[model samples]
Target: MLIKNYRTQFTEELTSIFDEKEIESFFYIILEAFHELKRVDLVLNPNLELDTIQLLQWETVLSQLKEQKPIQYILGETEFFGLPFYVNENTLIPRPETEELVEWIIEDLKIKKFKDLKILDIGTGSGCIAITLAKNLPNASVFAIDVSEKALVTAKKNAELNEVKVTFIEKNILETEDLNQQFDIIVSNPPYVRNLEKQEIHKNVLEYEPHLALFVEDNDALLFYRKITELATKNLSKNGQLYFEINQYLGKEMVELLEKYNFENIELKKDIYGNDRMIRCVLKS
Candidate 1:
């Protein structure tokens, strides 16, 4: 079938679930993943046709999309910080907001003259943050911890794919009483979405994404943040920095929690959306 015709059929099938813009985006993503035909290729060569086997594969992908499966999971991989990562139901798919958090850390490191820096990434699903740090800052020692062994396996595979070394260990952050070594930088994109907000999430996410990595109780929304901050006070190197990708709704609360621990230079920054999406704090030297 011609690319144009297939797109029309795909769009019509998905129109009920997703709008025109979303369907278009999904179409190009799947086309590139399955056929290596990019959006530009489709525009320039509108007559490009899928062979019999290719048509079968395209139809299979379409079926999954119709069922509201995430395009990333269907492709089984995604790009983050210019590196490819394998993703599955065991992990939360890396989001662009998290990419901003990673960029913030990299930029901060560039300004600091510290050498041989040690970094820790808590709840390192898919190892996106830890692997990106190791890949970007070649001299840094990176360690990541996750509660799920299955998630850690996926994270380790991503590290291998990116060709960067990161130490991965399994530990529940809530139960983590000690971190033996001090880190020059500690960062986390912990589960900050409250259970009450689940109604606001799209069905695709609530159904396909791992809830263990995305939610906390509405009454105690800052559970992970409090735990990580407490540990940072004890384990963070003097003058070390702490970073978090936080819920925009609780920016003030997050900053207050850090301040209660005597974290200095606490700054809450907005993401591209102008919502409070990230925070940075420094430990007293």
Candidate 2:
């Protein structure tokens, strides 16, 4: 019942499945979210105890974690680009690599002081990218689209929660012929993982994350990228930029793909882990 006792029990129970530090970290996260109690609270009040309902909450989370469910999904929320987002089985949890992509766009456009720019986020998932951009770049009009209406519902809630206005559309990119509306920037962190690469995924992700938002056929790994590029060819404004959070193994292939599509100033960037994880290209002015 005591906070310290629960912390130790939590780590011991999850030690076989997760690292001690990770379990401790997740414990602190849940602790704060559920009880508004921080690590310092446990230290200052060593006798602090969890009530019956709170103990049950911890038990439920532990059970889900043992099944390799993601903590974000267990909590039904996550933070992206320093903003909170609601997430569920329908959406892919936004990742740090995608935050880097958003930062790159923000840094470029903030310096340019672009006015009334239009930004589109294909496969928006939790609306993290669109809402973050709208929050950061007040001058930009943000729009996001996903094939799943369920994902869009969560994305819209996230936008409202963050107090930023982003137009959310439920449309499958593969079935669409054109974007119709031209945009100064278009970004997508689509389903880039090849089916063969499932071996490389973490159990928590491969088992719990949305497969529709993560994977593509091994024989056609670039299916979403190709379709988005085709749409960009028709819909990107003159001087518009295109960005993608790409699969690390496909950097060279992505470069060739963009070249074929006539996207200039193509730049492939590495994430914090030093893997080629993002690419940006601009239309010829």
How do the predictions measure up, each by TM-score? 0.97, 0.98
Instruction: Report the poorest 10 consecutive residues by lDDT, candidate 1.
Output: 28-37
Give the alpha-carbon lDDT of every model: 0.92, 0.92
Give stretches of model 1 more than 4 Å off. Answer: none
Clashing pairs in 1: none
Clashing pairs in 2: none
lDDT of 1 at 73: 92
For model 1, how does the per-residue alpha-carbon lDDT over 38-107 read when each residue is reduced to its tens digit? 8888889999998999888888888998888998898899989889999999999998988999999999
